[model samples]
Target: MRLAPDRRTLLLGLGAAGLAPRVLAQPRFVVPPLAPLRMEVDRITKITVCVRPFRAAGPRLDVERVAGKRVVHNYGHGGSGWSLSWGSAQIAAGKALEGGVKEVAVIGCGAIGLTTALTLLRAGAKVTIYAKDRAPYTRSARATGTWSPDSRVADAAKVDAAFPALYEQMARTSYAAFQTLLGLPGEPVAWTDRYTLFDGPDPGVTFPQRPTTVPDIRFFGVPLRNLAPHWNDLEPSQHPFPVARARHGTSMQFNVAELAHLLTSDFLLEGGRIETRTFNTPADLGRLKERVVVNCTGYGARALWRDETVIPVRGQITWLAPQPEVRYGLYYRHVNVLPRPDGIVVQYGGDSEMWGYGSEDETPDLAEAEASIRTIAPLFEAPKA
Candidate 1:
């Protein structure tokens, strides 16, 4: 029953032809190469410092009656103040409006205070923000702003059993809230591709660890990690970094200058008043006519409330004048560079979570700033032709 040699050859050729179409039917996807960053050292602009109000047991979101004033505490978000603001604001403002207080006062104008005030105003309550400093002048402005919901959010060992669920809720809510701000004027909030460059042969294991000098004590809430915007491992040719490996993810960044303006404008447009006033003690809050107040003093909470629980984690940013062509952010050798609409922020987190975990120093270091530029400069070297 065997076919003759010529007939058998013809039958094999037909089978090969059939396989060709199936192979060709499959599509190939290529990762587009990214634009090279302009990492020149001379591009440096300004440097600033901020103290994140880290607390072991997470943010203080409790209520107390002080001097006949119902105080809704909403401070100590650590590095996550900006990221978790809206969600936590919803909680804080809800407590503030519990008794149906028509006139409410917010004591602090950082991300938390402003958002809480806006949330209160939207809840149809007359809100006034009485703070010593507004957005730009506050320590919140000096932050290395990023959507870091759990960046030193809490020491897991120190948080309560219920805290993780609460943290996840806040992170999820804030993620949804930021989405509505996309495509707005000024590009107040937007997504940027972030590349993490590694120099080792095996870039090793899952979730892709970035090397750090200090122990990473920061709490990582793994529940909402699926909500991570984007993640893709890139072949060496797909990226311009001169590294052994590169991993990419989409990180949400806030153009603080624009974001602050938008939040401030929105509050006022909705009939919320912002007064330049400072509170030195709990008694000062009683002087105001509003019976309900939400305390969002951030690191200042340490002094005003005499609450020793609030720990300060210092963070500094070295800004370079913005380059319109640069649209991406990157991490290399533990230093981070993000090109924002306002400025190109360069921060050295080589020490990782503990870099400034307990520091409160607000002094600007020019040498340390220059060192960051040096660390990132090598990656942007003109690629060989």
Candidate 2:
């Protein structure tokens, strides 16, 4: 799924994709009149969903001791896997380079694997991606493709004081890298304006409060510490809904399908190669021509590497007709509505947030799909007239 381009992408030389008749003809947005705040249940006829189930019966990761046989474990990122792929890959490869290996094998072909291959290629290391599946078909393609790092990475404080700096650096680097890709002929990546509405008391948190000149680090909604007035104001007539506050940010959005191909093409263009093979055991890492390996297996790490820390937090999304007029993304409570070129991706995080708490495997639940739509209906409700 691809997010529509916002203002930043244009300035950064990252152009938007072909606009639909409505979007291209009138690129401006006149805030729609607020209808009565009434939530209408979408008439869901046919349903499709992506289900992720978890089993506690796995090995916990000694994250510090993650690497093996010159292999740096880069999997187990869970939901944030796609959002943080390139950043994490850069970090993993940075560590892998310490081994001084000029060649590397990337162990999964999802977003993590593909990005790692590109990162390695840029580092002048020959890379071979070994995976069972390809893009669009891969699990990474199933994501809604928003750039927020929340819920995906481990707690910043727990990881280390320095870990936040590392995470922030990777994010900035990947942001720059993606911008470069967006400037290419295809416009494979871009940014979208995401609106996260809140109705209740303030979460008492601000974002982008501390300003950094870093390209990827920008203020979202309001300054992180500003409490005096507010960032955006809503008039009685233009209010979209009866919301206490709203925070909006320019977020990184990409067409996962295009991005997958872009990464692969970039690698091949740089003389990196890909091979198809499955590793049933860790021993396969030793057999590869590359001495260093970066694991991008995603959820597959559970069985292949017998990783216990890896847990599946199932997420499902509903694809709806493109509403190009809806210029912002919405996250209200657990339900989120993300607009993409193909359709709107809606999802709700259920018991799956329990982490190592569920017994269900990677099963698709259409009912859960319907339920997720119901959960976020309020955010899509029209404002009162």
Candidate 3:
């Protein structure tokens, strides 16, 4: 979408003052040549649902003694489990190691769990992951897999004054961890150009302003536009979409299929053990024999630990055949189209930013998938001159 007037002015002022010479010297935006998508309904290979374990006050990273066991809670990352897995896991593993435990049990085998287990292993702890499902089968696999460290991460009113700074630290730490995976075999993680498209100019929508007394929720008080290395405003003709304006940026997109396999493989090769089991209650953790446990159960913590605060934000995605020629992603209206190695993920983010809160339904709605596809199908049509 078109940049807000104030944002445009700020960016222009920076360029005019020669403060951002490298950015100002770059060529004006143009849509990268991409193959037109095959949007037929029959091309859909799978439809998956993910219930994000959203906590209003942000992810619960505290430690608690449960049944005489030191349980380091690491879940409730909301929509950022994959995005901030490593950093959050690092925190959890550190807590587990506080007791000088040589062995640890990691609950859940999702992205967060695996990362926690790996981090513990790296720290010389013998780790075992106990879970009902591993990656590719876990809810983490259903994610659209984009790097959005602060997407609905927490509620403004619920978070404490220190939450934003903590979030920034996690974001930066996770970003650095993911960078190490680049160019590795299977291309588990790679950068992709992303565009946020709008049908017209700015909608003039503004968030209900919060009082200054509260900590600023704007990701370390820095606008997201400025966070991306390549944030640019594109004219109508510069973007492939029929939308009148677009905000383009580069993001790290995860190939979850490859990533899961790679992580699991590495863990096994590194002497980490994974057990296929599910814990029905918190007491079940005591049977593991590990004195310390890191709970990366993700949404499962709701029932396992009876954590009512871990509300589920339901998300569904329709996967179409992969388009190797299409390397970028786009967000238009409420729909997001992300091209991954497995397939092109078409997801509905809903109307308002707070859409799908506390939704637990996991059934895939074909009608909803079709509706979302219809919204972006026109982008494949010949653009107007």
Alpha-carbon RMSD to native, per candidate: 8.0, 11.7, 7.2
The TM-score leader among the candidates is 1
lDDT of 3 by residue, 117-202 (tens): 99999999999999999977899988888887877678777789888778877777788899999999778999988888777323
What is the lDDT of every predicted structure here? 0.81, 0.58, 0.81
- lDDT measured at residue 105 in model 3 versus the true structure, 0 to 100: 93
User: After superposition, which runs of candidate 3 have C-alpha atoms over 4 Å from their true positions?
Assistant: 1-25, 200-227
Clash total of candidate 1: 0
lDDT of 1 by residue, 77-173 (tens): 9889999999999999989999768999999999999889998999999999999999799877777768889887888878888888888888888
In lDDT terms, how accurate is model 1?
Answer: 0.81
- What does candidate 1 score on TM? 0.87
Q: Clashing residue pairs, candidate 1?
A: none
TM-score of 3: 0.86
- Per residue, candidate 2 scores C-alpha lDDT tens digits across 1-107 of 22345555454442234342222221223244322211223644333333232222211122232224666777766555565667778778887777577887888
Tell me the lDDT of model 3 at 99: 60
